[model samples]
Target: MHDGIVVYPTDTLYGLGGDALSDEAIMKVFEAKGREYHKPISIAVSDPDMIRAVACVDELAEEFIDQFLPGPVTVILPARTILSSWLTAGTKKIGIRYPNHEIALELISRFDSPITATSANLSGGPDPVSLDLCTVPYDCAINAGPLSGIPSTVVDLELREIIRAGAEIDAVAAFLAQWS
Candidate 1:
């Protein structure tokens, strides 16, 4: 599935995934969700090595990853040129997820690259915790029963702020508080 979209389960919610490096695949994801081009999409990586390949994980980001990753958190960091501008929405930063779900990890591992990690629903739709709520077009679906129903917390590591609070808000906030 080099340039195809897939609906797969994540630790938090089902994600509409596609090749992060493929403009065609990324566009398909956006079209499937009816998401605007200006909105940035996050990517899911199986491990730290994949994270480093796509993003510029600074010392602080590295520390943050060590502390809170392999879980439900989206860490925003400086983008490496290897990623398409379409994926990052022309922003020089990118949000990355290292999910704690086995199926999610296996999907990325088998694909051998990062995939778009946006929720599998319309742009303003409810969180898709189950396959019935996906409401999007995809080449394949990996129904892992149901997810946690909450979305991953989006933390901008560069600005040291939580853009969107979801899972582990208290712990994530406390960790960021240390920098303040």
Candidate 2:
């Protein structure tokens, strides 16, 4: 986020990113995208270990992540002590991902906290797959060429089940199946 705001293509869509732990920066994302405060956002980290720093990651979740991360998968887990209520929407849990893109990985590494991965589009709109088609109302956009074009598979580790199907399932499924 050269302009002090970061935007990048995620597994699901182009995401308007910012300091995950910053209330002000997070507020800006909500204002810029016109997103509702009630709906919590997801965060992306460069490594699975980073997930533990932000949330209370369990052994099972770690196992799944060891196999599925650095790819299309968003794991929902309990938030750690420091997450803002704004990020969790009053819930005790948070959604996290490690996108399979070098640029995204680098951004998360640089930011040093889980970065928000909410779609760049306004609420209830199609995700932008290309810069030409991107319509996010933001001051900066970190275009990493075309996206992988497939959304990350969303799995609720809280309940140990898959909530939304996306591009990479076999990989995630195989990981989760090991838990059973």
Best by lDDT: 1
lDDT tens digits by residue: candidate 2, 1-180: 532456787765677788888888788888877889998888888997888888888788877777778777888999997888898999888999888877888878887777788777777767678776566577677776677667778898878788888877876677678776
Between which residue pairs do clashes occur in model 2?
Answer: none
lDDT of 1 at 26: 94
Per-candidate local distance difference test: 0.94, 0.79
Query: Best candidate, TM-score-wise?
Result: 1
Q: What is the TM-score of each candidate against the true structure?
A: 0.98, 0.90
Model 2: lowest-lDDT 10 consecutive positions: 1-10
Model 1: which ten-residue window has the lowest total lDDT? 54-63
> After superposition, which runs of candidate 2 have C-alpha atoms over 4 Å from their true positions?
1-4, 178-180
